[model samples]
Target: MAMMKLEHVGIMVSELERSMAFYTDVLGMELVGTLDHNTPGIRLAFLSYPGQTAQLELIEGYADRLPDEGQVHHVAITVDDIEAEVARLRAKGVRFLDEAITTLRNGARYIFFAGPDGERLELFQPPRG
Candidate 1:
């Protein structure tokens, strides 16, 4: 019935490994995991405080160019029930970037929708036990 919490913020990077080092080695965040993204040519790495769930997702090979200020791919929010949330949003005329929901290798499901200013926003449903 409501969004659970902010899942993670996705950022576009030109180099996945470099960004991973900077975030983990320099910032002291722990590398939670990495995955070959479902999208071709794209890679993903997650980092966060040790023993905690990942709070940042770094993406590479998504785009050839990123602005000097950096690009935020999207802000993800966790939802208890993705299907219901999607339906609710659709009823309000929310614009979705894609029609199908994507399930990750770990069983996490997500879908992206356009925000008010066309900013990307994602709704994530973690794997259910």
Candidate 2:
């Protein structure tokens, strides 16, 4: 069998510029590159995490249109502090989909949010002893 690793998670956004500000300025992700596709009137921007192996790909499709509801599946990122991260994001006007932090069977804490285009994104931190 071959080994597999996650390269990036693609999120379809309605506003590329707004999403860029959030991911790059607020979240501190590096903008690696961007591609403009005229045929579909969409643009794709790739972001890389510093000192990490994964990336977040943002897709802005048809500047004048919005993606259908329930289009985004979800993207989860492991954070160092769930509360602190949530606070920081909240201060930046980020809204959470749920009020309470979700705890998994393995004792991990997480929260979800809707991105610029309504893409579901998650921030999580594992419990410690």
Candidate 3:
């Protein structure tokens, strides 16, 4: 009952720099900060929108081999224009799992794509007014 809002979602990554670039350069998230995790051989990096507090934490050196779907099933980022966002990512060589955007019963549209570390990422558009 004390929970206020979703703070962050952390995903394991192999290479910190590469994953950071994918989220920052390709996805357009701003790099919040990077730091050495308490555990040895582990590093942490946080990213978010230019002026937002909620973050996506990228953790490195947690696992030697990552599964195809990675640890997290998928991380969805809300978008205003799903089509334009898909086109933008496609131009950057991003691979999508879904051939076309999926429309939900409530008119929400979404599409899944692979991240640098093979983590699933989704772009979602809520119903229009």
Candidate with the greatest TM-score versus the true structure: 1
Query: Please, what are the lDDT tens digits per residue for candidate 3 over residues 1-129?
Result: 122244556788889999999999999999987877545898878799988867887989988988888675457677788888888889999999999997755576778899998888778675699
* TM-score to native of every candidate shown: 0.93, 0.47, 0.54
Model 2 per-residue lDDT tens digits across residues 1-129: 111244456677888889888999999998887777434666867788788767786878744555576244467676777778788888999989989787754465767887898777777564577
Worst 10 residues of 2 by lDDT: 1-10
lDDT of prediction 2: 0.72
Best by lDDT: 1
**Number of backbone collisions per candidate:** 0, 0, 0
User: Could you tell which candidate, 2 or 3, scores higher by TM-score?
Assistant: 3
> What tens digits encode model 1's per-residue C-alpha lDDT throughout 1-129?
579888999999999999999998899998888999788899999889887664899999998999999999999999999999999999999999988899988889999999999999999998888
Q: Which ten residues in a row are the worst by lDDT in model 1?
A: 46-55
Model 2: residues with Cα > 4 Å off, grouped in runs = 1-3, 62-129
Extract clashing residue pairs from model 2. none
Model 1 lDDT, residue 45, Cα: 92
Candidate 1: global Cα-lDDT? 0.92
lDDT of 2 at 19: 89
Query: How does each model score on lDDT?
Result: 0.92, 0.72, 0.79
